[model samples]
Target: MKAGRKVWSVLMLTLIIAVIAAGCGGGNGKNTGGNAQPGNSAGTTKTSTKDNKDVVIAVNANFITLDPHNASDTNSISGARTMYEGLLGFDENMGLSPALATEYKISDDGLTYTFTLREGVKFHDGTDFNSEAVAINIARIQDEKNNLRLRKSFAKVAKVETPDAKTVVFTLTEPYNAFLNKVAMAGMISPKALEEKGENIVKEPVGTGAFKFKEWVQGDRLVVVKNEEYWQVGVPKVDSVTFRPVPENGSRIAMLKTSEADFIYPMPTEQVSEVEGVEGIKINKVDSTIVRYVTLNTTKKPYDDLKVRQAINYAINKEAYIKVVKSGLGKKLDSTMSSKTQHYSQQNGYDFDLEKAKSLLAEAGYPNGFEAEIWGENDSETIKGMQFISQQLAQVGIKVEVKSMEGGTLSDMINSAKTPEEAKIQMWYVSWSPSSGDADGATRGLFSSEMWPPAGANTAYYKNENVDKWIAEANKSIDPKVAKDIYANIQKTIWEDAPWAFMGVDQIVSGSRDYLNGVKVYPDGSINIRQAEVK
Candidate 1:
């Protein structure tokens, strides 16, 4: 027993050493890392192709799925983006931009959206992209039989019409202010592939983009080759782009240093100084919408009590968490979404007060720390964050056992629960970005009662009559000011409810070879390789 204990301690200490050696920008809509240097201008990657060299990018997590209609994680969405072009897209700062759709218009009532499909666009499968393709993609998402993640968001669609080869119109059941944003989130998949591949399309993706999916060796690499017959001329500067999933921080950084990987993201925060002045390498730090937090399952005991939830928030030291866990590359999370997100409003956050946390715990009938488990992805930085939470909670009479699982495993564990009562999760240390670039994207899926477990990401099982109503009211509201006001109310109420221990906002820190250009990280943390080049 003693020997086993020593071995376990040694392994943990080694992991801490490797993990604490991290540094960078986190994803955000507002500021980059508080004190981290902005290595270069955010979107200065060269757009023109100079060479047909293959580019390699190393990321910290494996992609979950490539099917855009069902992609739930950022990495998976990014992987899908390599081969898929949405009707609309986001600019660097997350402003809506035209992609497959050349022009779009919204009705005054916000119930109808009409788009002019880009002319001469062809899918990797050689099928023409037109209004019919758009209708097919929307139908796939709207069909409940498909069980797509995008189904709920598109449920408002009452009808999709293809009046001509180039025009697509959508009529919603009611006014939805975010219809345009949701359209941007909908990536265009080949109608041919959809009809033939069916459910297999998740693994075998066919789309109309600058790149075409070559192969995906799960957990190893997802490779996309340049489309020789791409519609947009003089684009896709590289011959091929290979995304390698190197989860270990040390391994990923080493690949960048040894020139094995042309680029790496989440440039280990603690190791940023080590690579800042290195030759032949460039770092890009961008303000993003990524925010980290720990979800406390409100359906469970202790966490069910508002006082207990508030105590956990008070117990965490936000500033120290940024410095220690994030290696000073992040800002304390002030709201559920980063200030960069649209309709963001700040609120008074629970400051670190160990005494107050203890007092609250005592009032909740636990004078001594209660034993609980904290869950996180099995990554160096995530484990460190979980450890930091564990230590902070211990000071306030909360004894937490940290459990780290792979991203897919952790996701399955949380989502496998058929109901709230079946969920075994106590706390989950995770990060989220409003990839859709809307406050509704940030708030609704996470806090709405209609979204729970397999349905959506409301892991807290947080349900409030007013919050639910405000979400609906906000969605139906066409006026930005009215939506802002309703969102503010929702934020304030949830802030008081304390369903999560708001951690910090991340600045996306990434490193690229000087020769590798045009790959940029969006404010939502999804990597854009539409114009990747080996200059």
Candidate 2:
């Protein structure tokens, strides 16, 4: 029964690109197609992704949920986007873009934000798109009882008023530079569906996007059909969009080559060479905001000790992580946030040192490494990453058992723990991108004590009095300089605290058949299919 709880309630919850010479497929992810590799590198004979009526996306993991607010992971957020619309949205570059809202203005005083609604738009369920609909959506996220992961993003909202059918205004208690980005992340749900479906809306979602949910079989495939009533005219170019989860690298690669999948994300950097000379497949690489790390649960045993946490960071070889795990396609993470992120500030230390790691482990009362379990998604790369980490940690006398699961099941395990004492994760090998594209989005949800699982994604259960104060100060600052300084302190403190084993930032690589067009992966590593069509 607990597992049946809506993900909306639970899951609210990079790199250098130095290997560009080795041909990883380039796209700075700044603009849609700029700097990308040619559609067909080989320019050989093959069936074009052209002239097809439907498109299939093969992803490395399963979607966690369809509920926009509760869609915690990028895959879930990507799936939700097919059926959802927000007052504001992020462009391919992660810049703020108007979605349901036609235009907006912020008061010079920095507390009030006013938006004009897009008219003549109807949700997939036929509900009118208006100020009230936006109000209803924000209200759900603001409610603490619902435990929405999006709550923190909207925490500053002091008031929301619909001045007219087309106008909605928000008054925040304090200034938050990231507010607009947060607003963009809140995919607007249909008021009619929310009232009717209630919690069931997680499975039966309704929205105002180019496509509508047709079927979701879970762990297999999810389908969406063109929304005839979609506000954007001449869109939904494909008759249907199917998302298949093929976790195995070999199988996913085979699917794309055999025409079973038109596109596959995480194109398995190790296999990029296999598809490069292929006839119908194209490889796309981009500098991204994604960071990979092993979350060391501070509330759990062997990790509660600060020295233990630091040792884990010291033990992992960040260089090998890029060279071996990422196939020399990424940069070693230099800070809590990717260097590509706004307000990013670098912190020193955490370089690979086996002797130092062993010493730290001994100092932490673990002269003979203690046994622990590490968790990750059941995908070839992730399992490989985990194995790599396990082997590296082994050198420091830390023996770990690796565990992997589907995205949905992983989300459930992390969120089911209502409190830190009930949490089970000792270490989690995971990757994160602040989909909202802000420093607060990167820091708060993962490091703030207030965000501990079920409320937000602070799965490490890390907390600090000074760090918390700095986070609040940073959020409330109106000047960029002041916010920048505060964020610097937050990063410096977190880096020393070592709640995570800083790994590497990704050089995002994805592949699609030469015939596929318009589907793109944003800098935040989110899949965008709004304009997906055959070549």
- Against the true structure, candidate 1 has what lDDT? 0.84
How good is model 2 by TM-score? 0.90
How would you encode candidate 2's per-residue C-alpha lDDT over 1-535 as one tens digit per residue? 4444333222211122233322223222221111122233333437554556788888888888898998779899899988898888888878888889999999998999999999999988887989998889999999989978788789999999999999999999989888988989898888999989999899988999999999998878889999998887889788899888777766666666666778889887877875676777788998999999999999888899999998889887788679767888899999999998889999889887666788888898998889999999977789878877877787678898989997778888988999999999999999999999999989998888888888887888999989989989898888999999999999999999999999999999999988888999998889988898785
Whole-model lDDT per candidate? 0.84, 0.84
TM-score of each: 0.91, 0.90
lDDT of 1 by residue, 1-535 (tens): 6677456545644554354443322322121111112333233323222244888888878888899988878999899988888899889898999899889888887888989988999999999999999988898898888778888899999999999999999999998988788888889999999889878888888998889998998878899998988888898778888888766666666666556678888787867776776667787888779999999999999899999999999887788789777778889998888999989989996987666788888999987969999998866678778887887787666899999987889889998997998999999999999888999899998999988988899999999999999999999999999999999999999999999999999988999888787999998999999878776
